[model samples]
Target: MVGVETSQHVQLSYEPAGVGDRVLAYLLDGFFMGVYFFVVFWIWGYWYSLGSDPADLSLSWVFYVVIVLPLMLYHLVSEVLWKGYSPGKKIVGIRVVKVDGSRADLSGYLIRWLFRLVEISMTSGVIAFVAVIMNGKGQRLGDMVGKTCVIKERKKAKLEDTLFKDVSEGYEPVFPQVTELNDKDIRVIQDVLDARSHYEYDTWFKMLKRTRQKLEARLGVQDHGMRTDVFLETIIKDYNAIHGSVK
Candidate 1:
């Protein structure tokens, strides 16, 4: 397990995916690619099947643009669109992340994708397997160069561990409706809140909006132009005030 300190200084632990799991994910991704190839071949003609030297100009150009280019960019496109999860990685419950539990930038993703040609395609994954096993952090050559690692998506900390704190003296509660949230709900809110700084702006905004909508529906309260992050922060403080540790 790797320990990461969030921007808030909260300690979070993530288990690195094993080499075996990564290999399985790779194979699964290959299977997805094979499916894609079969579909493209079926839709277009089997021009590249076995010694077919036909000269159909438009068909050939269409195939090259539709099939070849996308095939070449598949891994890169998938990771970016899904935020570090290829379809296979999403199914396997693992994802790419920076060492410090932050979202990796586009350059990092590109580096990893570029290295895939040598690490997996050229070497048949031998180099990647060895590197991932030798390093305890589940990093292949791509991950090392990209400064990222694959980690299991399971969160380690339980709600009981940090659900309540000592409410400061002279604190006024903003929303009595916060008590409508149970401990589990509080934990989910806290998790999203703590994780906000780790994501880039767009992702964080979407997440905040979703969480805020859900809370507003349940609590019968609207933000009324209040910032959503502040709404959640105030919820946590109000919860602490209601059911906090003894002073």
Candidate 2:
């Protein structure tokens, strides 16, 4: 496990898979590619065996193109649309992201796919597999070209189980309100929390003021004097409280 302190509030932890998830993804992709390649090869061979001129043998490239197209397209679409995890990757709970902690884009995806040829050149992609295991960021040559890293999503810790392990239970906040907040506001708060280390006290103060203003505008509340940290904490506490009760 490699711990990257992305920010004071967001400690990004990399859960390294010991040759398990990678092997699984490789097996799944290999299975898909093998099936696809076999079908295309069979069709192409059949078409050629039907007395089609050997001079036109280059048409077999079409099958290769067809097979390659889906692989490229799937990666591009999944990275851009779903922020990384293709069906196989999602099933295995691994996702790719840029080194700077952003989602991969079209250029990055293309670079990744193009460089994958180098990674998989030798039999079984053992070189790439070794690179992933040895690299600090769990990145292969393709991932280096794409400036991406694979990471597993952190499992959500059960609050009740941890919180009550030491204390005798019945802890509650002083006030709870089921106030509505907009998605943009929520994203802003999350971003702020994620940027804690990059921001100074004055910068945080300014952001808090802006957040409060945005909250006031969105929620139509004229007076919300709670400090930004307190406000966020309260909202999360109330949400957990209500959510726990409902569950």
> 27-69, model 2: which lDDT tens digit per residue?
7766766787789868878988999876675755764577767
Give the candidate number with the greatest TM-score. 1
How far is 122's C-alpha from truth in model 1 (Å)?
0.5
How many pairs of residues collide in model 2?
0
Task: Supply candidate 2's per-residue lDDT for 51.
Answer: 91
Task: List candidate 2 segments past 4 Å from native.
Answer: 1-9, 14-18, 41-61, 67-82, 155-173, 176-235, 239-245
Per-model TM values vs. the true structure:
0.62, 0.56
**Prediction 2 TM-score vs. true:** 0.56
lDDT, each prediction? 0.79, 0.61
Q: For residue 243, what is the lDDT in candidate 1?
A: 78
